[model samples]
Target: MITKGRVTATLDGDFVVFMIGFRLNKIWAIHKWLPVFLAMPKMLKELNSNKDLGYLHHEIWFGRTLILVQYWRSKEKLLAYAKNKDAQHLPAWKAFNQSIGSEGSVGIWHETYQATRGTYENIYVNMPSFGLGKAGKLQFVGKGQNNAQQRFEKNE
Candidate 1:
């Protein structure tokens, strides 16, 4: 399933930190790969269906490890999908645990934060060799507009 959400807060300047995760079941080593192929189309469909949800950022590392970073307008919208029992997410979570929970064939994890009290900045540079470079710089807002402007200028 496509992990979806919005940015709650910016942290450490570059990190547009939010909560996201997905679950996948283990397939027989021989046939396991088949599910991924079958699932891709469905997953992609769901993602496209929620196009207006938020800014979706994700990366699949080493194939199995899925990482998603997104910015959302509020936590309510994020939680609504997560709590949807009939959605693809709920069934997928069950299947993953049943098939891979024991052998560690499948697993899912997520972290959520309430972003408050910080100024955040980020840069995304796409390079041919590197694909994408991401950075987050954050600091406390102090004094007034003058201080914030100075910090922002320094960062630029």
Candidate 2:
């Protein structure tokens, strides 16, 4: 449901923001890009099914350049999940390297960020819980959290 008023979110401690995506360099090369595109859902399902993986939540946008923003409980957990041999990510990564490496038919990239309390602030107006709000604590904007500056100043 849509939240009618301004809302904010806060995580208890440090968090990780992982942005991962692919660009269809050759849109017609379905053979190459399709597999890459298909791999993500499997990984997502794996992560979601196992909370111990430290996967928090994610938001995705699709197009020629797909974008996925993921939240994680910690950087160590994120790296562990990426490198785990038992996970779907490693296999999918290997397949991508073998099938599409340097050919440019599909391009993939990711960036990771470590966030601590007092380092981030967010607000959502007239929207349902989303992004950090979905991954962390969601609440109505309070007296000291009404503005970005104020939110940033919060002691947490």
Candidate 3:
């Protein structure tokens, strides 16, 4: 099991954060939606096994839409992985285009964020490790780091 804490995450410098997920527009169409849902786990497995891919870690939330929060070592690494033919992403993306192009039976989307040291702040009180805390490191949220405002002021 993982330990819980009020610690803040620590990182060397700027890192690329990617939010990627898929939605099932036509939930009844198992043929259309199943492949979309199944493809990610295979891609995730490949990424998890290869450290050079820059996939640090992920947290998933499932509903009508599935959300995956991904942390990468850098933007370049993420792009390289996405474009590499030998890698899982490119093939998946190509297949997605070929199989589900504009049909809207299944939908996929992603958002990206860039974060740097002292530019962002997070606080977790009486909660398990999560988000930035889970993806990066967590420092002790002590006397000076008790609240978000204090954390930002002191951390920056």
For residue 92, model 2's alpha carbon misses the true position, in angstroms, by: 0.5
lDDT digits (tens) for residues 8-121 of candidate 2: 888888999999999999998999999999999999999999999999999999999999999999999999999999999999999999998999999999999999877889
Off by over 4 Å in 2: none
lDDT of 3 by residue, 38-141 (tens): 88899889989998888888889998899999988899988898889897787778888999989999889999888776677877766677777777887777
Using lDDT, give the best candidate's number: 2
The C-alpha RMSD of each candidate to the native structure, in angstroms, is 9.2, 0.8, 1.6
What are the TM-scores, per candidate, against the unseen true structure? 0.50, 0.98, 0.91
lDDT of 3 at 125: 65
lDDT of 1 by residue, 11-122 (tens): 3323234644444445346344344334434544565587454323434444455555554434665566556785565566566566555664444567765443334322
In model 1, what is the error at residue 34, expressed in angstroms?
Answer: 5.9
State, as a TM-score between 0 and 1, how close model 2 is to the true structure. Answer: 0.98
Give lDDT: candidate 3, residue 56: 85
Rank the models by TM-score, top first. 2, 3, 1
Report how far residue 98 has shifted in candidate 1, in Å: 2.2
Candidate numbers sorted by lDDT from highest down: 2, 3, 1
Q: Ten consecutive residues with minimal summed lDDT in candidate 3?
A: 1-10
**Of the candidates numbered 1 and 3, which has the greater lDDT value?**
3
